[model samples]
Target: MKPLVVLVGATASGKTGLSVELAQRLDGEVINGDSMQLYRGMDIGTAKITADETQGVPHHLFDILEVTEEASVVQYQALARQTIAAIRERGKTPILVGGSGLYLRAATDVIEFPPTDPGLRAQIEAELESEGTAVLREQLREADPESAAVIKDARRLVRALEVVRLTGRTFTSFLPQRNHLPSLEPVLQLGMKIERSLLHERIADRVHQMHSTGLLEEVRRLDAAGLRKGRTASAAIGYQQFLRVIDGVLTEEQAVEETIIATRKFARRQETWFRADARITWLDTACEQLIDQALEAVRG
Candidate 1:
């Protein structure tokens, strides 16, 4: 079986187009590693590739969730591994592409994720809402000092609390996810790098294009589909802003500008996250022979 080839990059860095091109060249199947693209109705905001754009390359793990459903990284890891195996079974290489750093890492790394309990998760989420993340961070500091120090955000903090509460074990005890670890399988990880000014321009242009291309309409449709009920989907950059457009809060113009700013910051965070992993072979997206370079990286 062909070993996996994974692509990492920030939003609007040309990963989608390049993924399709590579799949065409390498006899590979494409898998969606982006967290937002998993939703069926999130196309315009997510820049989901169209069927026409695919040019007949098979894709997986996309459009598999309702807008109301939440996405789980642990579930994605299992499903992605199963998908990679299935693709290999049919004698094809698997090319995973996205800007989601954790999702990509989770899919490739040998992470023994802590167990989950939905009821406990709900209670913890309510505590987060009531007590705020700062207070929860204090509790986590007492419960698991190492994780409390390393884990940065509320989402991971919530999960860490869940693990500590559920099994009476520290989150750090379950897996070595804090650092770049070996993959369970042989794989090549490729990262896309772009000049910062050019990347900002790309993000601004993409968000403007999304605005002109009926992003609000798509969000309206998703709002009707209970997008706000899904914690992850609701907090997604554009959707959250446009759902406000539906609520008469942010005007379309304001939402577009906010989305652009938010996306640029998101791109920076993606850069920071992926840069920590020394395993990835970085590629300049502007290189004339990028596909060739990518192929060489895969083979080398």
Candidate 2:
């Protein structure tokens, strides 16, 4: 089987344009690895590539879910693997592209998720609601200190607790190792590297462009479609801020500023995650011959 080309980067670091060009050059089909891009009607906020921007390349896994649905990494892994196999069977290369670290890892790495019990999960969620996240955090701390130290979100806390209770094992035990999945197709991992200052500027500019392109209106449409009811969708950076604007808790200007700040922070986190993986070949985005360098790296 041909190796998979995994193009990963921070948001607004030029992954989309480069991936499209690479796909055209390599005769590859682009697969969506970004978690948010899976939802329909989230185009503007998620910075989804336009049909024209796809440049005649076939893309998979974009806009596959409704706003009300929650996305699971387990489900995504299955779907992405299936897509990759089909693409390769057709004799086309599969280019996996996105900024979503866990999603990308799930699609390419050897990882197994623990089983979920709805009853146990519901019980844990009730405890979270009644006693609050602090209680759950303390519980996780006692049970799985590693997960406790890093997981701050209520949902994740609940999940860690649930796993610990169900399997009597640490949540971290299920984490993907720094190696590829057995029997899976090999992958050439590429990362985009940019100067911090320039990346921040690019993030701010992208946020501004998202606003000008009617991100608020897109949020409004999704909100009307029950976005707030969706745990994952409502918590997205731009959508969360704009939802506040819709509720009159924040001005449009304030929402844009918040989105910019949030995006910069998210980009930083993305950099931290991707940089830790030494297997990835980091290409400076400033290089004019970036695509050539990437092709060379792959060929070599």
Candidate 3:
């Protein structure tokens, strides 16, 4: 089997451009692993690759969801695996690209997600609504410190607590192990490594560029299309800050500044998550001969 090629990195680390080049050279189809990029009309904030950027390569799993619909990792895993199999069967390399670590692992690794209980989930959600995320975060800290340490939002915290209550096991226990699943093909994981200071500067510039490119206009359009109704979409980095602008709580300048800060923090979290996986081959994205280096890594 042709090993699946995965390109992972923090936001603004230039994965899209390099992935397109690699796909062109390798005759590969790009499969998006970013969670937010799945939603349609989320182009600007998600930094989704444009048609021209794709360089005529076939891309899968992009713009697959409505803004109001929540994305599930379980569903994404099944879809991504199916896509990978079809691509391989067609004699095309499957290049998985994005910064979402869990989603990437879900697609390529032997991870089993826990079943959900609507009643229990509803109860936990109600508690979260009434008590706020702080209370549930503490509860999760006690039940599953590993999950709590990483999961920042109320929805995820509630889910983790629900899993703990329903299965009597820590949420982290259901995470992907170091070993690969026998049923799936092996993956060559490549991660983009950038200097922290340069990455921060890139993130700041990207945020400014997003604002300049009418990200607020995009947010306004999405909000009109029920963006706030979608839990996941509403909580996205740029969208949330812009939503605050819409709510009259923040000025546009404040929104822009806040978005930069939030993005920097998110990049840090992404780096921490991907760095924990020793299987990935880290490459310097800033190098002039990045494509050649990446190709050598794959071929070697």
Best by TM-score: 2
Error of 1 at 59 (Å): 0.9
The 10-residue segment of model 3 with minimum total lDDT is 176-185
| Model 3: residue 19 alpha-carbon error in angstroms | 0.5
Candidate 3 global lDDT: 0.92
Give residue 122's lDDT in candidate 1 (0 to 100): 93
Give one digit per residue, the lDDT tens place, for model 1 in 1-300. Answer: 477999998899989888988898889999999999999989999999999999999999999899889898888998999999999999899999998877887888877777889999999999999989999999999999999999998898999999999999998898655455778778888999999999999999999999999999999898888898998999999999999989999999999999999999999999998888778899999999999999899888
Which should have the higher TM-score, number 1 or number 2?
Answer: 2
Off by over 4 Å in 2: 179-183
Q: What's the lDDT for residue 176 in model 3?
A: 73
List per-prediction Cα lDDT, in the order shown: 0.91, 0.92, 0.92
TM-score of each: 0.93, 0.97, 0.92
Candidate 2, residues 1-300, lDDT tens digits: the string is 778999999999999999998898888999999999999999999999999999899999999999899999999999999999999999999999999998998888778898899999999999988998887899899999998999978888889999999999999998776644553668899999999999999988888999999999999999999999999989999999999999999999999999999999999999999988888999989999999988998888
Q: After superposing candidate 3, which stretches have Cα over 4 Å from the reference?
A: 127-153, 177-183
- All candidates in order of TM-score, best leading: 2, 1, 3
